[model samples]
Target: MGDFVLSGNVTRRENKLIPHWKGPHRVVVTNNGWTYDVQEFVAPFAIITRHIMRLKIFRDKYLGVTEDLWEYATYANGGHMVQRFLDCKMKFDTHQWEVLVQWRGLDEAENSWEPARILLEDFPLLLARWVRTDAKAEGMRSFVLNETSSRRGK
Candidate 1:
């Protein structure tokens, strides 16, 4: 593969509630599509060869600069509370809902997915916003369906 970045694997050391996907380590070499050699700056100039499944293609916009990655990891690892809720979704298997939250003072890329109930209880304002946004989306969806049906009738 061309220049790419590797994503961090989930670890018990990290808070299980938070959705973590850290990294954008630069790839130094590639052994066809099966494996790649990457450099980890934080690991102190260490090079590692990993299978293709363990790596993700690097996107400059989403990953941002290498410096920012370190800052994000520090903030996230520090157990800082989430700043605000961005979105929410229900889990298909567990039927439990989760919210996408952005931590205070951190970049959007540092946002994590958290359990909706915990967020609602901890940050009540998030519940209000979620209700308002959901209502608006439902209204828009109904409007679209009505318009489509009217056009079909005509």
Candidate 2:
């Protein structure tokens, strides 16, 4: 057996801040017992996004969350925020990253619906599909469509 490892990062898309956690994370991330990882993920955005604040035109425009809020990664130039926590020596199996992407999109849509129902209804699925396709381009195999449930088995 291998020791569990934790890695995390915070991401900003439009006005929302999403925290990402990965363990040698082969499955869903638990919501507790990973404060350090969560803190690391959120600290950067909390520090720099201060200056980017602006008043939101509509209370529920971009989802229920305030559009005026900014995140730490927003200060940087390109690429999404990524903090790799556990690169275990044991070779983890290659799995499709798209399913993860779709799952996240669905989760976000649910969270955002109350604040921004229009976006949840309009573009999230399209965005999720695009992200899934992008993950494929980055060398992840499609787990749901082609292979075994355990990515390691492949």
Candidate 3:
């Protein structure tokens, strides 16, 4: 039941030219062979469930690398799509602004700081959204920070 398997059309497809199967997901529930529940995450939870007929046993080609990433979330030239901008900072030497980019399908810890100039050029809309975020204008006492270790999601 722990073996990975390739999946069929679990999600709706916009383009018909994509690959037929996109996963080698770990089987979470066998469902007695009628239906199987598969999880693509390293975390312990099932994200997809499909009938047995739409699945095929998968064999790993590379050792220790098995996560089936977002086959449909990349940009045209295989670039990572930014989910959002989480933080902002000024570069120490260049004095240029940088924003922390939260990539699609990745966790918060995987986020990275990118040049604001580049982002403003590549993704102006995203940079605009980040600029419009509440501004953390705590100087006006409307928003609070450093009050506690707990914080809400953006």
The regions of model 3 sitting more than 4 angstroms off are 1-77, 136-154
Candidate 2 wrongly placed segments (more than 4 Å): 1-6, 25-154
With a 3 Å backbone cut-off (N, CA, C), the pairs that clash in candidate 2 are 7-85, 45-72, 63-115, 63-116, 64-115, 64-116
Model 1 C-alpha lDDT versus the unseen true structure: 0.56
C-alpha RMSD for every candidate: 15.1, 18.0, 12.7
What's the true lDDT of residue 137 in model 2? 28
Error (Å) of candidate 2 at residue 44 is: 22
Please give the distance, in angstroms, between residue 151's alpha carbon in candidate 3 and its true position after superposition.
36
Q: List pairs with backbone clashes in candidate 3.
A: none
Estimate TM-scores for all models.
Answer: 0.36, 0.16, 0.40
Q: What is the lDDT of candidate 2?
A: 0.26
Task: Please give the CA lDDT of all the candidate structures.
Answer: 0.56, 0.26, 0.57
What ranking of all candidate models by TM-score puts the best one first? 3, 1, 2
lDDT of 2 at 74: 24
lDDT of 2 by residue, 29-96 (tens): 33343222121222342211111021111121222221111221221122222111111111246321
Which residues of candidate 1, in runs, are more than 4 Å off? Answer: 1-4, 8-22, 60-66, 69-101, 104-154
TM-score (C-alpha) between model 2 and the true structure? 0.16
